[model samples]
Target: MFGLWAPERPTEAAVRSEIWSLGARHQGRPLEGALAELEADEITSGRAALLRACVAKLRPAKVRR
Candidate 1:
C-alpha cells in the first residue's frame, strides 16, 4: 500500500511489479468497493509496477476509455 504524495509521478516498474503480485494473490476473487460495480474481469498481464499499484489499490486504468 502507498500513501498520498504531495505530487504524483509516472508509475515505475517496481511499483508495477507490486501490482502484478497483488493481482495474482486476489486473482478470481470478488472485490467490493466504491468502484465495485465496475467489472474487474482481468488482472493485467504486463507493466509489473503499474499492475502492482493497481492491484494494491484500485488505480485508474492507464489507457483512457
Candidate 2:
C-alpha cells in the first residue's frame, strides 16, 4: 500500500484544540449534538465521528472544573 493512500490520524492535542475551538463557536450546545447537526448539513460521517470521539475524550476534563 502506498503511503499516499492513507489518511493521517490527528494527534490528541490537535483534536482537543479543535474541540475547544468548536465549542467556542457554538457555546451552550453539546458538542455531540452539534456535530450530529453538522453531519446532516453534508459533513462526512467519518469526520463527524472523529470529532465526536475527540469531544467524548475531553468531556471529563470539562466536568472536573
Candidate 3:
C-alpha cells in the first residue's frame, strides 16, 4: 500500500473511480473479475486509493517482466 491521501473527489465517486481503474489495470490480466468485484462494491474508497497507489508503485515491475 502506497499510503495515498484521502481523495478530493466527493467521497464515494472518487473511491468508485479508483476501484474501477485499479480493477481495469491490475488484479492480473483480463479484468472481468476485477471489474465485477469493483461493481459489486467489494472495494472501499480508502482501499481503492491504497490499491491504486500500490499498482502505480509496482508498475516498474510490470515493465521489467
Candidate 4:
C-alpha cells in the first residue's frame, strides 16, 4: 500500500469545527460515521452537504499532472 497520505489531511477536529462554523444539519450526530461515508463518496443528502464541502475545502488542492 502506498503511504501517500497528504501531510494536510483533514482531522476530526477540523471536520467538527467546520461543521459548527457552517451550521451543518448533521452537527450533533456522530461525525466518524458521516466522515467514513463521505470518504467513500456516497450519495449525499442535504444533511451531509456542508460536511462534503468542508472536506473538499480542507483537502490540499490537487495538481494537474
TM-score winner: 2
Q: What is the model-wide C-alpha lDDT for candidate 2?
A: 0.65
How many angstroms is residue 8 displaced in model 3 relative to the true structure, after the best TM-score fit? 7.6
lDDT per residue, candidate 4, 3-65, as tens digits?
454233456677667656544545554354456556655563544665675656555699999
Assess the local accuracy of residue 11 in candidate 1 as a C-alpha lDDT between 0 and 100: 62
* Local accuracy of candidate 3 as per-residue lDDT tens digits, 1-65: 44366463335555456546755666643244443444555678855554455444434554463
Which model, 2 or 3, shows the larger TM-score? 2
Q: Identify the superior model by lDDT, candidate 3 or candidate 4.
A: 4
The worst-scoring run of ten residues by lDDT in candidate 3 lies at 29-38
Between 1 and 2, whose TM-score is larger? 2
Model 3, residue 3: C-alpha shift (Å): 16
Number of clashing residue pairs in every model?
A: 10, 0, 0, 0
CA shift at 49, candidate 1, in angstroms?
A: 13
**Once model 1 is optimally superposed onto the true structure by TM-score, how far is the C-alpha of residue 44 displaced, in angstroms?**
26
Output the TM-score of candidate 3: 0.33
Q: What does candidate 2's lDDT look like per residue over 1-65, in tens digits?
A: 77576656767876777776667776754575456555676776556666766766756665464
Per-residue lDDT, model 2, residue 58, is 50
**lDDT of each candidate versus the true structure:** 0.43, 0.65, 0.50, 0.57
CA error at residue 12 for candidate 4, angstroms: 19
- As for candidate 2, its clashing pairs are none
